[model samples]
Target chain A: MIEVQNISFAYKKRTPVLKDFSLSIAPGGIYGLLGRNGAGKSTLLYLIAGLLKPDDGKVLFNGVDTRLRKPSSVSDIFIVPEEFDLPSISLKKYLSLNSRFYPNFSEEDLHRHLDTFELTPDLNLGALSMGQKKKAFMCFALACNTPLLLLDEPTNGLDIPGKSRFRKFIVSSMNDERTILISTHQVRDIDRILDYIIITETNRVLFDQPVSKILSRLKFMTTDKQQLIEDALYSQPSVGGANIILPNTDDIDTELNLESLFEFALVNPQALIDAFTNNINA
Target chain B: MIDNRFRISRTFDLFRLYIIENRKFLLICAAAIVGILICVAISIASDVSYKRAYSMYRPDLDPAIPYLVPTYIIIGYIFAALGASFMFSELKSKQGRIRTLMVPANSSEKLISRMLVYVVLYTVFYVLAICIAEFFRDIYLMAKMTVAPVTPLYTIFGNEAAINFLTTDKYPILLPCILFVGVFAIQSFFVLGSTLWYKYSSVKTFALFFALFFFYTISVFMLGSSLSEGKTYNNLDHFMSNYFGYVFLCFEIIVCLFNWCMAWWRLRETDVITTKR
Candidate 1:
């Protein structure tokens, strides 16, 4: 489990990016952390990874303070940043250097991931295209088998086929113990895979809930009726009608439209929070 | 939970990774060292041949042996400085900064592992390079001696004159070791500077170090002048030789240790955004 307790952080001499923000992530399943630009999404991820220390409060991974960046915590976590550079060395050499750090690293898993990506370990990482390099790194990260995997914009450079392959690989690579947190603006890339969603805005968590719970509580619908659109908690016009979100008054399972849901949460965060809170109390 | 302290196995693992990533750079350094050694050997041999041919008539040819060892030591120091300056070079780059920080080891382990490679390992290589250069110099001298009567290779190459000059220390090894420490202490300062400043760290360090060095030198001179009043140059020389040298050595060690510790602390504070005040 990862617990962030009222962590506040900012770049020196700059305004605070995250102020007294808190969240917890339990093990298992994929989590999609969505936020507007400059909403502290990457900052939060860095704080959790122990890459940047919070100015106040703490981040704990399995009861260990992540700020310490101890071997136990670091070894069980791997982060793939949006942009990275690989050394001018063979993929095999790159893996040899990095793999030993992860005690659970699997050579067979690495080979499998590479094969899935149509990459061979013999290729020089520096020579590969950016997308290919990303795939190779993703392959290595998966092979590490760490309990927590943090991926920032993992699909940024991937082609359509590569993105599909990435989705497939992520699903196949997941285990019950692993908790994968993906932070990306490209919600469509990972909308189906995310079991949980976190939305942040203006240095605070606007929403944090499981997809199943969210789907059960909110009725996502497309309506042409002006009365229904105005009465809705959040609504947006579509081609033939308007996509709207309302309280699941009848407790029907509505198919989630993630883009619409994101817009709804941002526009009507208080209403969404109130509905969940009222439901919990009742 | 995680062990925050050092572990030998993990340190080795970190070191191994460092070597793998930097193997290309190390190879290039090795090739450059060898090339330098060969060049020095050829130059020294040519000089020896020229001296041997002219000495019979001129008879005033200065023996190069007395100066060669010290010259090679100076060369070794230059290479050591170059190698150490890039110790934290990766931290300057955007991708490398993130990757290095994200490597699954504590900051101390990471620092120590790199210190071992940058300082200790580089020192070992420097010593080996000196030894290899000495061997080439000896071989050239030996080939020269076959045709003409020259200074014995053993006396010159085995550090006879240099050792004899420092015989006051009893252990001849102490002098070279002391010299190594002095050079390493200065180089370690550059290592710290490289870690702290991102762009042209070595040049910046060089400037800062020399400026301070000159300031210290002037302060010491002025203080000595004030204290001596009407003393002779010989009296001041004696005081400087007996006391100032030891004080300077102590000062160097302190500066080296202080800067190295500061570098470690700075690394702990370092993050992806280096522009942060």
Candidate 2:
């Protein structure tokens, strides 16, 4: 588990990226952290991973300050930055050198993850394409078996199949003892795989809810009926109809449309908050 | 209670990782050192041959003897300084900084591992390269000379300054200790600078060092002149003559420790994203 307590951070000579922001993530479940460009999604991930220190307050992992970067704390956390470099060495050599730091590293899990991504253990990382390198790095990251995994733009450079394999990789690696917070704007690539959805903006979290609760509170549908559009909480035009979010008054369940939900949260944040708050009251 | 912050096993792991990551660069440095030494040897051989053909040739004259030690010391210092300054070159880029900081080793382990590679191991490699280069130089000289020289190869370890310092100095062991600490202090300064400024670290460190040294020299000169103005004491002269080595050694040791500590602190505070402190 991780706790962000009233933390504020800014780059040199710039406005604060995150101002008095706070977030708590419990163990287990895949979290989809959604935000637009420059929305501080990656900054939040870095702060949680202890790659950046907060100007005020602190981020604690299991009661230990992450900024301290104590071995005991860092060993339990793994981060895959949006852009990274893999050493120009064979996969086996790289694993042999790096895996000893993580006590829970599993070679078996590594092989399985690599298989899911259709990669081999004998890979010469330098010879691989950028996409392949990302896959290889992700496989190793999952195999580290860290309790907290913070991924920034996990599917950024992936091809279509690579993205599909990435989703499978995440699902296969998921367990009750692990928490994976994926920060990405490529919503469709990860929306279906997320257990919880969190939409954030510059200094605030607009919405945070489990997928089941989101479904229970709002209905997502594409309809041509003008009446539904007028009454809809949020609506976006589609080819044949308009995609709309409505209060689930009929008690019917629909698949969560993450794209529409994210748009709704940003456009009418108050309505989104009221929808969830009214349901909790009821 | 065991201190988990400085685990020997983790430090060794990090050391091994650094070695593997930079093995290619190490190999290239070794090759380049050997190549430069051989070229210097070849130039010396050519000059000896020219002397034999055009003027007086003495079988007792060995031209390479004088250049060996100075060459080793000069090249070794430059290489060591440059290597020390580049110890944290990975921190120059955002991606590199992220990868380095995210590795599950403590700052102590990381800094120690880098010191092992760039300082200790590099010195050993440089010495070995000098020996190997000397061997090749001797072979080339023997083939070029009509008369075989009395001394074939000058031993790098048996250099005159080292021998004289060890055998003739009043405090033989203390002099070497001072020299060792002085070397470490210089290297630590470069390492500290590397952490302070990731880009163009070596050049910046050299400029800063010269500036500080200039100011320090002036300050010491003025202070010494004022302090000694009213006093022409034989006691001061005798005390300085007797205790100067010890004082210099202590100063070097303190400088070395301070630089290392500051470097480690800077490394500990490094963030993947550069921001104002």
Model 2 Cα shift for residue B12 (angstroms)? 1.1
Candidate number with greatest DockQ: 1
Q: Flag regions of model 1 displaced more than 4 Å.
A: A12-14, A223-228, A279-282, B1-3, B44-62, B134-159, B165-174, B220-243
lDDT of 2: 0.83
Tell me how far the alpha carbon of residue B153 in candidate 1 is from the true structure, in angstroms, after superposition. Answer: 8.7
Q: List the residue pairs that clash in candidate 1.
A: none
lDDT of 1 by residue, A138-223 (tens): 99999999999999999999999899889888998999999999999999888888899999996799999999999888888998
Count: clashes, candidate 2: 0
lDDT against the true structure, each candidate: 0.80, 0.83
Positional deviation of residue A59's Cα in model 2 after best superposition, in angstroms = 0.5
Task: Compute each candidate's TM-score over C-alphas.
Answer: 0.89, 0.91
Q: What is the lDDT of residue B108 in candidate 1?
A: 74
- Residue-wise lDDT of candidate 2 within B1-277, one digit each (tens)? 1134688888889999988988898788778987887776666655554234222443343445555555666677778888899899999999989888888888999999999998898878777777777777777766665453423344524444335423334554665565567667778889999999999999999999879768865765565446668443344333244555576578778878999999999999998877564
